[model samples]
Target chain A: MNPPNIIFIVFDTLRRDICSIYGGDVKTPNIEEFLKDSNIFPRAVSSSPWTVPSHMSFFTGLYAREHGVHEDLEHGDGRVLDKIYEYNGDNIISYLKQKGYLTIGYSTNPWLSPGTGFDRNFSSFTFFSSEYMNLEEMNAVNEYKRYGKNRYEAAKNLILSGNFQEFLKYYRIHKRIIKRKREVGYPFIKGSDLIFDHIMNSSYEEPFFIFINLMESHEPSALWELDIDDRKIKYLDLSGREIISEKKMERTRNGYKRSLEILDFQFGRLIKYLKKMKLYDNTMIIVTSDHGQALKEKRKIPYYGHGNFLYDEIIEVPLIIKFNNNVKINIKNWNQSLVNIPEQIKNSIEGSMDDYMTSEYVFSESFGPVHDFETLIKEGILPSDINFSLMNEKMFYPKKAVYWKNYKLVLNGLTGELDEFTENGKSQDPNEKKEIVENLKEQIYIFKGQESFRV
Target chain B: MTQEIRIEGGLSLNAKVAIAKIVINDAIDRFKRPFVVWSAGKDSMVVLHLVRNVAEERHMDMLPALFIDHGQHYEETIEMLDKISKEWNFKVIYARNEDALSAVKGNKIYLKDLNKENQEEAKKIAQPGEILKDENGEYFEYSLETSVGNHILKTIAMNNAIKRYRIDALFTGIRWDENPARSWEVFISPRENPPHVRVHPILPFTERNIWEYTFKNNLPIHPLYYQGYRSIDGKYDSKKTSDKPAWEQDLEHTKERAGRSQDKEGMMEKLRRFGYM
Candidate 1:
């Protein structure tokens, strides 16, 4: 008997709410259709808020404490890789490869490319350059310069010019110049297209494990065919410019929405191709994200991003597992960690794994400081010098958490407060913070074997 | 008058800092030939980072670490081990119990494997002036080959490597708080045997302390912690429960019973019945 083939897909920085299946506003029909027959984990929490560590955890099944590649700092030396391997030990790819599986990985995130030890287990791994920007033929840099200053006007001008390619070029260039200036040096390549081609062409001789990471949802949103003017928007917030007009923000959001729609369409096509090729049935397909992207929400803090803090927007992601055989499981009101996916896959293949637990407790860590730190410093509960790194040295707490049964805990690092919420997303009484804090403190003190520290 | 108070139990901030600094310093001092008993968990990663930092501080010696791999581990454990080893130049030794067990099964009966006949014979021989001896009337001579089985037994086991290197001292990044077995462990201890000593430089450290240290020092750590894992032990528990036999669950049990946990004794007995001890 042959081992089962595995197809793992990670949409980079995709928020859970954006998926139609997760009760978001986006019209992700393809994703919704995929989820209908698949095992969807509605409450899958990411291992980390960033690409490097989160992806590492996905492969190794060990937390950052065990595998040791927690930060995105480029040590500029090869020693960092050595440390990662020492902690993670053997990777799943190598194990699968040893078991006669062909492993391949493709990613658009530069951080997860070959140099990062992510390539260690895969027989073949490829990272597409960010230069290609999008499927549109326009260069990202030029597009930004043309329309980024005044998005509405620029978009209007491109529309009037009646050149869709010019509009795409403007959008790509604006996106590239605005946020990812460092990547401008690299050439562009259409990663999604490359991946689609690979999937269609790869040999299925041995059981194959293919990992694909797409960065279409990453910030500085770019889209080629949004029904909006590119010239009327103002993109340069860096030049001491006035605040971006509401119209521009709206257009940006609209463009992002349109891009997501396009991605969904492409995904549908890929799925259709897989089914047509008769490879969709036996494959154990996993769809998830490294982490969710923050779309500028005020969670006591007025900004949106993942690396500097932990929040539901950043850590909570949609996890969908679909097998060739139709097996239906409705996992409601259950909080599952993404780390359990590998074990679940094994269980599915071998029929000898534990059932998903009910009273599961999830843990998370962040090395970088968040708004909670500022709050703590302001209240004199923590010293000003107690930054993210400093706090991480002294404590281990998730930035945001949802319990298996909906007893949620959100630790605001900046405020030094742990807020409790009901499973229905209702906030608990403020008085309950004290008890939660006390329990958390006790757990920390006991877990660390330190009896001297009192809360 | 000055209080002249002697601080007991709780460590001061300065003391904590000093201890942390010493950990870093000691790690740096042995940067050239640092080897960690990598268990693919959090404590071990802390140990790995200390060694990395030490090697970086020296700017001359390249520290290579090693992990004695037990065969039965989670998939993530192996992934992390391979990932970290590739990134940090750590040498991994994946030891297999099957081979070791096969090698020693033919010649000897480990205490756990003693059959009823052997038990009765040993009991009879111990009687006053009964002359305790093997069936051949000679002193019982047990060898590794005879006891463990020749097919599985190797001359030099993974445990023996530490002794063979004449290691100045072996460092383990074990924290007392996480496990009851380690809660009372001291920072450093002399091994009962020569040429090997056990050191827990991070014993006094907390999870937060390690994270803070790594963050402040801009040290690298595994990312899974950020996702929601408290520590790196791969065994996922449905709930935090104490399931071990009462006697085997605490230090007092080991002290009372010749260095064996009651759970271990039970396991040994089971293995003995199966002739695999």
Candidate 2:
């Protein structure tokens, strides 16, 4: 039997808090409009803080350690599987290909290009190649580590040697590099054009699986807007400002809201396209984010970018699925992991997706804190309002958080410290929480079989 | 002669018979002191037949059949009960109100053949049921309230008989599609106080399957069912409108308990919840 076409629209770094569907400040009409017919998972979490590892879960149905892609502890080491030498045909890409699906991919992030081993199974793949005008590419130019480890060593020596005049010159050159930055639209307009292009141009004679990774909601968003009143309400316009302050962080918070408006507009357009093509009913459209942004909301971690900590701000992402019918059902299975993305797709094809459950436990993990604890402390990250104890013992611990029933336990590998979040992410009930922590620890031990974890 | 009984758009005659056997062997017969509540209706007769057939095949003990005499059944039904009881050598128990027994004489209706002039005399001798009806009638109110009262009286008698026979589980032939309340009932229902259980073995069957199974097997049922009566309670609480038998009537418009006069008032569920099978 031919499988229904699968379209995975992953909004890179789009957090759960901003989507109005989950009761946030931003009004995402496209997402809300889709919610009328789709199933909304309010508390769906991401596997990782960034695009690379998080998308790996969607493909392999495996966590960080199991899939072997995690935070690059040794940065710029060729040991990283950024580019694949061969297609293994073991992951979701190959799995779907064997099922007779024509696989294609469109990415805006060069890091997600074939060089990063992210696009191996796509029969045809498209990347903008030159649009690195935002933060990631400009920063790559700043460190002089744009794409290679050779320049990284040279740039490290130049910055470490502390030649003030040469450093200023390099900063001037980096400013010039940023000035030439493209992708000024940030995420939405260009993306919608590509989606509509696919729909209008396709013969669509056979079932096809299209994977889209849009990077508009990621950090350093410029020119994003939505009119709330006579005056426009949006994230701060970070045009020429490089210096950081309380003013900048507040604007970044607003930036997330403005980014959501763009996401909603572009997403609505594609949905309209799907309907116009009359493929809305038979097609399976899944919209979710790879992970969320920190926005420095709680001051738990510093900076507006993610990949530093496992706060709800960083891991929680909105998930919505629309297929044929519009009957809304509450699927209360708390154990749905991001790693089961492939399984969800398979079940959708087989007509056996149980909206209520997938397993007893869903997981989220981090190789280490998004930033090394030492860097965070040295960066004056712990605000004066909070205590030192939170970052003291549990700081350096490489952790994995498992959600069970009504409790979430963060298993710290370094100190074996079990950090608990109770119902609605509270931590007050120690007596009841400890027992659950211990049982979940044991379940993990049984699952891994070879290692012992401190409860 | 198999009935293509469409239940929930799925159930067929083979499925109905298979479900009957499974419910009997798996749930009903699992309990000690199990007994069948036979109403001498098509449904109850099928339950009895399934049990007898299971016993013959598996060498299981034959359960005692109990009947609650509400003093309103026809003479032919009472006669068929005696005949079937003797033929199968099945132990039979009768539960009835002691005062009402005297009103019935030798397998005949109580005071039913009286002249219009003698009706007042009969009314004077009539006793009120546990539940009183506002409307006036001879011997009984003949209203839904009276039917509910009679149902309670019958249930009390059945409970007494259950205690006498030490019945732990009572097997019934109620189908889900039969009535509104039964649709929500399960195959095995629990009763707390007496620690008794109600096992409904024919829950998934439809009315057509009941009739077709009986017609094909030539199983004995109430004689009134064939005499233009689809269902039975008594002459006063019944609809004898059609000339054709129950199975012969169009199944769509033919309600299972439409003939039961009290059932028209929709009090059957109340009686059912009160332990009246």
Candidate 3:
């Protein structure tokens, strides 16, 4: 009868195909067990296949156009919070806080910080801190705590250094390396560990909203820790020569599976902890992922990245909700979106059918890391590796895709090609399926989010 | 030939300069020799200076600007115009009612038609609050049809000048806030049917913009402006009559053209309709 305590969990980069609950080959018994009384969504796609912009949509109920937080690889300049303030005014966290929920955030994502306006309205917010958990990097820990200010101050320093362009160029050149090094100090804490700590230590009031992003199941090669990866994550010039032997590939696959099992175990622990506190009966659980992993499957080149692509392996992920208190609402076996979960939860709280949202289509976009084509070409990257014509037409071709029923149309803004796909990511013959293709293209063109952005 | 120049506009001093240059360039291209109606006021002076600058920049012929000598201007105003004309080397058409010009030039044959005694009486300058009386303190009924009214004579001289120069276009520094009739005017407007066009380069500029641009560019404004005579015209506009003059009045509180007697008679609308700047 009372307001339910909501638990929103994001198993970062957890593929729907790999999760047993979504009928994947991998064993995720914990998620499968959680699905018994939960409403399950098999094909829930993210607004973006990455954390920052995707989470922006989740918080504000707006697409990238409305939030204006798409990745700007060209500038690589300011924080997402500065860009987001102009567009995102109404926040779901603030709404739920007004509704008398003791909101708390337990996230490992830097994108989910106060810098990005994500930590507002939360009574207590804890991060899976790199220094606090690892205890080896004290200075990095301080920088972690002062993330926004530090980044801002560093940017100011760069500008005041009187060589801002050089600084930007250097940052752009070494950004991926710096990022990889920075991830060494990233909060790589396991979800189960966080849940255990919360259960054992912190005591909050009833009807609390806990938002969690667990990063144990993030990348296949670097599944063990953010520090251990030696191989470069190739995307633009994945010339197939970067392929590891079958034995090494099997080891990487096993490492990903091991991390998945750990995530599942941790999920089970979270559920068990809730039951132990006599809170399982009253808690509402919404399960999904920020994105899915890409393990160089069904492609010409060996690519091991997610954010740069819009394939089902990158965007399509699971959505599960155990709303035991709100028994009147149950959606099953229909194509929906991970984006609608925030609004749906708000509607379920307000007990309104008129304002409740339902969507027959879901959309996704890929803002970029900005591949330097000149460097790619000079490095003797074959045209087969990445079609040069796509880059030739536009310096960067950010992709926008819309999924309706079984059909999906991916429009590459740079190349100006609208590639359509049918079920299981199979390329569709557009001439044969003329009506749906044309109707879907028109609908995409006229969509409210694409009004100003003709590309 | 008129030199071609790029036209870009913004709410800045540089943009106004660019727009002024474009207006002058466009006038040259659009007409045989376009005529600009110069009033020796701040707006007119700044725009005229801009035309001179553009001419110097492009190494093109200067604007064929015409100053309508209404025969009632102060000697000081005439001195300032002569000085500027000598500096800029622009073609100066001292357009008048022809009879007025003849009288000034002492051409007795043309001046014989004038009534000498009434002309001397009409020419006698009087101080403010002394000569004018209509029960209303301010002159407000606007008309331009009278033979003696300067509006008709100015329009006649302007039309003759347009015909003499074979000008297909005329550029005017008539700002939007001057009157209700000029408020809705666009940047480029065609008048007197086809071919004869009116180009308003600074139509979007406000009074504040004009002042700000003058100060920003260090453009020389008329000397009377500093003496609190904001709207400086030849005959009726002095610090004595209309009190401190319309220019001295708070631009926000009072209309800029309020000091001019002919505007009160609604003659400005008729003059504009007759293609008078």
Which candidate achieves the best lDDT against the true structure? 2
DockQ of each: 0.03, 0.01, 0.01
What is the TM-score of candidate 2? 0.51
Instruction: List where candidate 2 sits over 4 angstroms from the true fold.
Output: A72-78, A82-89, A129-183, A186-205, A222-244, A299-303, A324-330, A369-395, A447-453, B1-277
**Per-residue CA lDDT of candidate 3, range B71-136, in tens?**
667777788788877776755667766554444332111223334532432233212322233433
> Which residue pairs in candidate 3 collide?
B141-B265, B142-B265, B142-B266, B143-B265, B230-B247
Q: Write the per-residue lDDT of candidate 3 for residues A1-455, one digit (tens) a residue.
A: 68788888888877778877766667878877777767676568888877877877777766664466766545321345577655536678888899899998888665676555678668877776422333333334344323223334445666777857745753453455446445653223344475556755777797788888877666534433233232233433343444445565565666666767777877898888787887876777888887887776765334465675777888888777777453535454446766676677886666532212335667787655434444433333323356545433432446777888777887765554674456556887888888987666644553422122332
What's the lDDT of the predicted structure labeled candidate 1?
Answer: 0.53
Weakest lDDT window of 10 consecutive positions for candidate 2 chain B: B130-139
lDDT winner between candidates 1 and 3: 3
| TM-score between model 1 and native | 0.52
Model 2 chain A scores worst on lDDT over the 10 consecutive residues at A227-236
How far in Å is the alpha carbon of A191 misplaced in model 3?
5.1
Provide TM-scores for the models: 0.52, 0.51, 0.52
Give, for candidate 3 chain A, the lowest lDDT window spanning 10 residues. A446-455
RMSD of each: 17.9, 21.3, 23.1
lDDT of each: 0.53, 0.63, 0.61
Candidate 1 docking: what grade?
Answer: incorrect
* Candidate 1 local lDDT, residue B26: 59
